[model samples]
Target: MKGRFSHGGGAGALARGRLARYGADMTQSLPAFAQNARFDVCALGNAIVDVLAPCEPAFLEAKGLVPGSMQLVDETQSATLYDAMAAGVEASGGSAGNTVAGVGSFGGRAAYIGKVAKDTLGEVFSHDIRAVGVHFDTPVLEDGAGNGFGTGRCLINVTPDGQRTMCTFLGAANQLTTADVDAGVIGDSAIVYLEGYLFDPAPARAAFEAAAAAAHAAGRKVAITLSDSFVVHRWRAELLAFIESSADIVLANEGELHALFETEDFDHAAAHLGRIVEVAAVTRGAAGSVLFRGGERVEVAAYPVEKVVDTTGAGDQYAAGVLLGLSRGLSLAQAGALGSLAASEVIAHWGPRPMVGLKSLAVQHGLSL
Candidate 1:
C-alpha cells in the first residue's frame, strides 16, 4: 500500500514543502454560489439500512468473503447471510445518507434524495434521517405483494481490526430515476453530492446527470465521491466523463484513486486527478489525506483517536466535513482538517453516524466552524 510520497528523502521533502505553500494560501476563495441557498449540501444515493455485527477473522474466511470489499447480493442471499450472522445492530445508512447525517451533526443545513420502498425499513430510514435534522421527503416506491424486495439493506461484518466487509441488497434503492431529481432542491443547495455506489443502475445514473444539470443551471456546485474501489473499477471511464462534464469536486480514498487511473503509482493517479477535476481530495486512512486544487496540493494529517471500533463510515463522514466546510467558505486545508476530525470520530464508534455533535467536537479541536 506504499506510494511514492509514502517514503522519505528528496521526493517526500519536496511534497512537504509544496503542501506547506498550499496551506499558506488559505486566503484564496472558492467559486461563488447563491448566498440564499437553503441547504449547505444535498446528497443523492441509495437509501438503505445497515446491519452491523462484529466477528472474528475466521468468520470471514469461513464465509468466503473478502475482508474489505463490498459485494452486491440478491434478497435470498442477503437473508441467508443475516440468518447466519451473530446478534447485530441496525441503523439507517448509505454512502450519501451517512454523509448528510454527518452534515446535520455538524449543525449544517442538509438534504437527502434517494429511493426507498413503503416498508418497515423504509420508515426507519426516513425517521432516523429526519431525527438527525436532515430534510428528506422523497416519494416512497410502492411495494407490490410477492415482489420479494421492499427496502435495501447492507450486511456489514467488522473484524477486530475495524475493517468492514459489506454485502448489500439493493432492492428498491436501485429504483431512483431522473423523475426523482427535484430541480427545486438542486437549485436551493450550495452543493449537490452524488454517490458512486448508485451508479450501477441506469435510472440512478440518469438521476445523477439530471441533478448535476439542475445544479449547474442554478449556478451551484456538484461534488462526487468514489464510494468504493470496486465501484471505481466497474465504471472508471463513465466516472471520468461525468467528473469532467459535471463535477466541481471529487472525493476518494487512495485505493479508489488507484482504481480510477488504473495505476499502482499514487503520484501518477493524483496528477491525473488534478488535471481533470477542479478540486480533488484523497483520503489515505491512517496516513491522512491529500487535497488537489488549481495545481497545488495540501496534505492534512489524520486526527488522533484512541481506538478504532469500526471503519464503516469513515470516508462518508470525511466527505461530510469537507463538503460542509466548502459550502461555508472554508479553505481547502481547513476543510480537510475538518474532514479528518469527523472521520476520526466515526471510526471510534460502531456505526457510520457520529455519536456526538460534530460541531462541538470541531470546536474542542480548535477548528472554527
Candidate 2:
C-alpha cells in the first residue's frame, strides 16, 4: 500500500504551509517516507463499552431520552437504563474508537488513546479493541484513582426503525487528561482523528488539544468529527477554532454541519465550512456524502443495503471509511466512496462495528483494494 494515498489536488503545498504555521518540523509539505510511518491514524476519544438492546418509542419517552441523540447519564441512570432495556448486546464502542477499528478493518495500521478503568468492563473494552487490530496504549485508571469512576459505557436503545438513542455514563472516560496523550505515538502517524463527544469533561478536552498539538508537531493531518448536533451547540466556539486552527479535515452529517454554522440551510454551512478548512466530508443519510476540498466538490452516492437493521455506528463507520482511505493514500473522492461503503456495512447489522470484514465488503463492491 505504499504511496496508495497521494492527496488528489495540490494538497501537499497547502498542508505543508499550514503545518509549518503550527511549528511541525518537516522538510517538505508531505511527510518524508510516508510508507515508513508506523501507523496510518492515531485516534483519541472516550473508551466506552456499548450495551445495545432493542426497545420501543415508549421506552425512550419513559427514560426521557431524545431519539437519535447522545446524552450523558450518571451511574445510577446507567444502571436503571440497563435494567429496563431489553437483552443487551455488549460491544466496544466510542466515536473515534469505531473509526480506528474501521481503519483496521480496511487493513490499515491504527492506534487509539483514551482512559478506561481497571475493571471488568474496562478489560472487555481493551480486549475487544485489540482483537480488532487497533493498538491501545493509554493506561487504565486504577480502582483508587480519583473519584474511581468505573469504565465508561453507553446504553443504546435501538428502535425498530434502526434509530439509536444513547444514554452514556462517561465514568473513567472523563478522567482523560493531557498526560494520556502519548506524543510519540501521535507524532508517528499520518493523521490524528478526534471525536467531538470527548468535550464532556474538562480534562478530556485538554487531552484533545494535547493530541492535536502532537499531531501538528509531526506535520500529520488532523481530522475531527462533529459527533452530534447537541455537542455542536455546547462547544460551538471551541469546535470552530479546532477546525480552523488545527484540523486539515472535518467529518460531519448534514444536521451537524448545519448546527455548527447555526443555520437551517445546509448548502450555506457547507460552503462556509469548506472556506475555513482544507477538506470537509458531509454525510447525508441515504442520499450519501459530499466531499469538499478547497474549491472542488465531489459527491459520492450512498452504498445500498438490503435492510437497515441498526444505524448505531453508521456515521462513525463513514468517518472510518474516509479516514482509512485518506490514510492509505486514496484520493479524497476515492476515500469518500470507501467511507460510503463502510457506512453501508455497519447499518446492515445490529452493532456499531461491522460484522463482516470491511476489506471483503470493499472487494464485494468491486472496489480494487
Candidate 3:
C-alpha cells in the first residue's frame, strides 16, 4: 500500500524495470523479522534431486521427449538417460520445494514436508535444502534404494535456448502419504503451500487435504499452484473443487489457468478463478503477471532480463516471491512485484535456486529486506 498502485482493471504497473533494478520506488526492503508463527511458508510437495546437463535438440527427438515439460519414466529409462548424458550437477528441487528454498533465500523462515529415501541422492536432497535454511524433517524410507531404484530424480536437459526437458523417476517421492503432513508444522506456518503435481501420487492428495485442514484449523492461509498445464488437464474437476473449498490463494501460469477453466481466453478463465478463490496470481512469461481479488485486479510487469538460460524453476520462484511478501505483510500489488523480481532472477540463470541471498538483493534494490 505504501508505493504500490491499487487501481482496478489493468491499471499501470507500480514497479517497472528501472525501479526494480534500483529499488528506488519501493518504500522499504523486506525485513527479516520475528513473527508469532514459526515459519513463513510451510511447503508440502515431492522431494527430488534434479540432474542438469546440456544437450542438443536431436537428443530430445531421439529419446521421444517433450521439450520444456516434465513426466514420469520407468527405472530402466531413467538409468539409460543418466548413463548417456554428460556428468550433471545435482540440485535439490521440486515445485513447492523450490518455493520454500526461495523464501529461505529471502531470509524468510520456512519449513518443508515431503518424502525421500535413505540413499545417496536423497541425502543430497536433504542436505542441499537444509543448507539453504529451510527446515525439513520428513522421515526417510529405509533401504529404499536397495537396487537401481532410489530417490526421485528429475533429469533435466538444457538445450542451447535455455529450455529444460524433464523426465522424472518418482521413486520414493511418490510414497508421500497423509501421515507425512505434520500438523504442528502446518499450524505453526503463516501459510501452507501445496503443489498440484502431488496429485500424481494419490496419497499426496490426502497429504494435501490434511495439510490444508491443519492450516485452516489453525487459522492460517492455504495456497495452491497448478504446477503444470498437463496436471491441470488431468485433475481439473478435483483441483477446482479443492481450490473452491480449501484454497485461499491460487497460483497458475497463463497456460495452466486456461487449462483449469477450460478456455483459451485468459480473462474469461481468470474471471472464473476470482469467483472460486479469494485471490489468484496468473503468470504470463515475459508479459508479466495479473492478480485478481474480488472486484479488483492489478497488472505487474515482468522485470527485465538479458537472458533466459533454463526456465525450470521460474514459476516456483515467482510463488516464492509472492508467498514471502505476503508473509512479510506486503500488499497484494507489492507481493506481485516481488514475484516478478524473483522470476526474473531465476530465468537469467541455469538453475531454479538463486545464487545469491535474495533478501540482500532486495535491500540493494532499495526494498526493506
Candidate 4:
C-alpha cells in the first residue's frame, strides 16, 4: 500500500479507451476491503515439497516423460523417480504456497491453508513457509490417518532449456477437506486465492467452495488460478462453473486459457473470460501478459531476464505480484507490470521461490511496493 506508481500511457491508455468504448463505468475500482483486513492474501493449495534436479532431454526420453508436462504418480513411482534423479535441491512448493510466499516477499500480509502429513517433508514445508513470513497453521494430517497417505512431494526434472517436467504424488495433500477451510482466515483476508491443482479431489473442491463463500460473505474478493493446462483440461466444465459462481478474479497462462475455452485463438479466449470474471490476467511467457476487466484490455510486456535457469513457478510468482498489487489498489496495467517483474526474477533462478527480496527488486525496477 506504499510507494505506489502513477499510471502511464500505452497499455494504461488502451485500457481506459476500451472501457470507454464499451460504455463500462471506469470509475468502479477494486474493493477497499484490503485497507482494513488483517491479511492481504490467504491461499489454499496442495502442500508439497519439490525435489528439483537438472537433466538432459534424453533423460526425459529414457524415462518416458514428456519434456514439459506434469503427471501424477503413486508413492512407489515417486520414489523410483527420485532415486533415478541426480543430486537435487528440496524446497517447499505448491502453486498457491509459492504465491503466498511471494506476497510475503513483497511485504504483504500473507497466509496459507493446506494439508500436509505429520512427516519430515511436512515439517520442512511448515518451517519453510513460516520462515518466509507467511501465516500457515493448518493442522498436519495425523500419521497412519488420511487414508494411508503421507506427505505429498513433486519430482521436477529441469532440462537445459529451463523447461520443467514434473511427477507429483498428492498423498496427504489430497486429504484437504472443508474442515480445513477456516472461515475466520477467509473473512480476515482481503483476497482468498484457490489453486486449481487442488480441484481434482472432492474434499478440496468443497473446501474451495466454503472458502469462497466465507470470503464473499465478509466482503472480501476471491481469486482462482488455472494452475496448468493439464488441470484445465481435467476439469474444464467444473472450473468454468466455479468461476462464474464464485471467483472475482481469474489468472492463467496462455495454454491454460486456450485449454479452458478449447481454442487456439488468444483474443477469443480472453474476450470470453472478460465477460465472465470481474478481472482476468493471462501470461504468455516471454511475450508478456494481457489483463482484462469488464470490456477493457491492457497488454503489459514481459520484464527482461538475463537468463532462464529454470522455468518452475513463473506463473505462481506472477500471481503473487498481481494479487498483491490489486490488494493495494493498483490499476490492472500496474498489476500486470508487477506480475511481469516477479516472473522475470523467478525464471532466472533454480527454484520456484524467489532468490532475492522481491520488495527490493520491485523498487529497483521502479515499481513501488
Candidate 5:
C-alpha cells in the first residue's frame, strides 16, 4: 500500500495511501500522525450541517433564493422550509469547514473552530470532519431549538447548471464567541484562515476579529474568504475596511470580487482589490484563477474536468489547496494551480467536499501534496 502511495513521500502520502486502499468507500481511516502533527494552517469559522438537494433553476425563482447567495433565515422559516423540502444528504459543512476538510484531504495538518449542538447533526458533523482528519474542538449546545438541539444547517440546493444556492439557519453556529477561539491554536499554525460568513453574526464576527488579532500577535499570517457575493453586498464598507487593515490573503470568485468592489468591470475591481489585501485570489470558474500581489498578476489555468456535478464547495476547497500550498512555501503560481486542480475534482462529484483520493490526485497532477 505504501508502494502505491510512496511517490515522493511528501505532504499527502498518508491521505494517498488511505485512499488508494479504500477508494471512495471511506473505510480506511487517516492515521493519527496526520492529525497530531503540527499544522501549517488552521481555520476558524461557523460549524454547520449542510442539507443538500438537487433542484431546478426554477426552484430558485419560486423560493426567491437569489442564486448562489447564502441567506440567513429565522428559526421558524428554516423549520418550515426544511419540512417542505425533499429528502437530501446531510453533510458536515460550513465555509471554513469545507476549506479545512479540503486541507485534511490533501494530508495537511488542519484544525477547525466553530460551534454546534449536541445532537444527531452535530454528531454527524463531528464524525465527517474528524474522519477526514481535521481537528475540530467546539462545544455543542445540549438543549436548543430546531434540529434536535444541534447546530444550524445550511440548506444547499444545487441547480442543474452546478450553481449552489444556500439558506443558513444560524442555530448554535452563531454561538461561537471570542472565547471559543484558542490563542494557542492560532499561534501554532503558520496561518489562520477566517471565513467572512462569520461576520454576518455579531458573536461569530467578534470571534473572527479576535482570531485575526491573535494570529497577528503571534506573528502568523491571516487569510480570509469573501464567502459570497451577496454577503459582500450586505457588508461592503465594513469588509473593505477589514481587508485593508487585517487580512493578509483574501479570496473571492469573479462575482464576489465584482460585488465587493461594486464595479461592473473586473479589471477595475482587480486593480482596486490588489491595493487592499496583500494577496488577492480571484477564481474565474472554468477560465481559471488570477492572483495579484505587490502589483504582479499570476494566472493559473483551471484543471480540465470531463464532468460537472456540484459547485457547492468549489471555492472553499480551492482556497484549502491554495492555503496548504502557500503554508508549505510553494510559490503563488503553484499554489493557485493546486487550488484549481482540487476545485476541478470536487465539481466533478456530487457533494461540496471531495469524494476522491485528493492527495493522490494532487500527486498525479504534480503537486507535492
Candidate 6:
C-alpha cells in the first residue's frame, strides 16, 4: 500500500511523490507488463469488430435506430446503414471481449473464443485481441464474403453526451459452431466466461453449451454476464434456466438484473437472483456494486472518475477487473473493488478499450493487478 492514499480515501504525500515520479501528465501512461505471467483465468464470447463513428441524434432517427439501445440487424440492413456512414475506428469488441481485454490490461492471463471471417475486419479483431495479450485460436471463415455476408461488425454511434447506440450485425459471429469450443482451452484455464447476448443465436447457444460442459467436466468454473436489458426480456426463461444449470458466477448491471427477474425494485430482483445462482454480482452505476454469495452480502463503493465520456464498456471492464482479482486469489470484496477501479478508468475515456495502463495504475492506487 506504499505511495497510495490513506484509509480515509485521501492520497498521502507519499502518493504525491509517486505520482510525480510516474509522470505528471497521466498515471495511466505507465506501460503494462505480465504478458506471460501464467494467469488464473480465461474466457469465451462473441468476437466482434467495432466500427465507431461520431454521430448526431438526427442520424439515429433517420436510420431508425433506437438511441441508447442495442438493436440486432440483418445483413442487408447492416450493410445498408454501414455503407452510408463515414469512416470509423475498427477495434476488437464483444461483451466478453471487453472483459478479457480488461483482464489483459490488468496483467492477467486470459484467452477468448469466438468466430470471425478471414477478412480485414477479422484480422483487425485478431490483432487487437492478441496485442492485448489474450490468446485467441478460433478459425476464421474463408467463404463468407462471396455470399454477400461480410465479417461480424458492430456499428457504434457515439453522441455528444458520450452515450453510445449500438447496431450489431452477427454475420460470421453467428456462425460460431460447436466445433469452435476447444476442450483443451476450456480445461487449461481456471474459468470460462460466456455472454448472454450469444444465447440469442442457435449456433452460438450450442457452442456455449458445449464450452460450459467442457469447463465443468474439466473441473473449471463457468461465468456469465447478462449483456443487456432487452436480451433478458427476450430470453428471460432461458436465462433463468441457465442460471440454474450452467452459470457459477453471474454479473449484471442494475437495469438488466431487474428486467431479468421481471421486478420493478432493485432489492426485490437482487434478493431473488441471489438465491438462484452460486454467486451474483449486480453493478449499480455511481452507486457502486453489490455481491451475493453463500448467504453473505458485500457492497463495494464506486471508484471516483473525473469524467464520464462513453458508458460503452464500463460493465465489461468491471467484470474483467473482478475476474482478474479472483484469479489472483483476492477476496470477493477485493475483487469487486478492483472491478470498480478498472470501470472508473474506462468511463474517463471514449472507447470500450482501456486507454490507461491498468497494471501500474493499480500499483499507484496501492493495488496489485
lDDT of 3 by residue, 69-116 (tens): 777888889989999887767889988889999999887789999888
In what order do the candidates fall by lDDT, top score first?
A: 4, 1, 2, 3, 5, 6
The better candidate by TM-score, 1 or 6, is 1
lDDT of 1 by residue, 197-224 (tens): 9789899999999999899888888899
Relative to the unseen true structure, what is the C-alpha lDDT of residue 190 in candidate 2, on a scale of 0 to 100?
Answer: 84
Pairs that clash in candidate 4: none
- Winner on TM-score between 4 and 6 is 4
lDDT of each: 0.86, 0.82, 0.81, 0.86, 0.79, 0.77
- Candidate 2 collision pairs: 4-329, 5-329, 5-330
Q: Could you give candidate 4's per-residue lDDT for residues 1-369 as a string of tens digits?
A: 112222223344334432111112422343466646788899999999999999999999999998888888998899899999999899999989999999999888899999999988889999999999999989899872346688899999999989999999999999999999989989999899999998888899999989998898888889999988898999999999999888889999999999999999999999999888888999999999999876679889998888899999999999999998778667787778878888999999899999999988877766765
Question: TM-scores for all candidates?
Answer: 0.91, 0.91, 0.90, 0.91, 0.88, 0.87
Q: List model 6 lDDT by residue over 258-348, tens digit each.
A: 8898888988889888887656789999999998766767788898977787778889999988776544444567677778888999888
| 1 against 2, candidate with superior lDDT | 1
Better structure of 3 and 6 per TM-score: 3
Which parts of model 6 have CA positions greater than 4 angstroms off? Answer: 1-39, 83-87
**Candidate structures ordered by TM-score, highest first:** 4, 1, 2, 3, 5, 6
Over 4 Å off, model 5: 1-37, 145-149
So what's the TM-score on candidate 4? 0.91
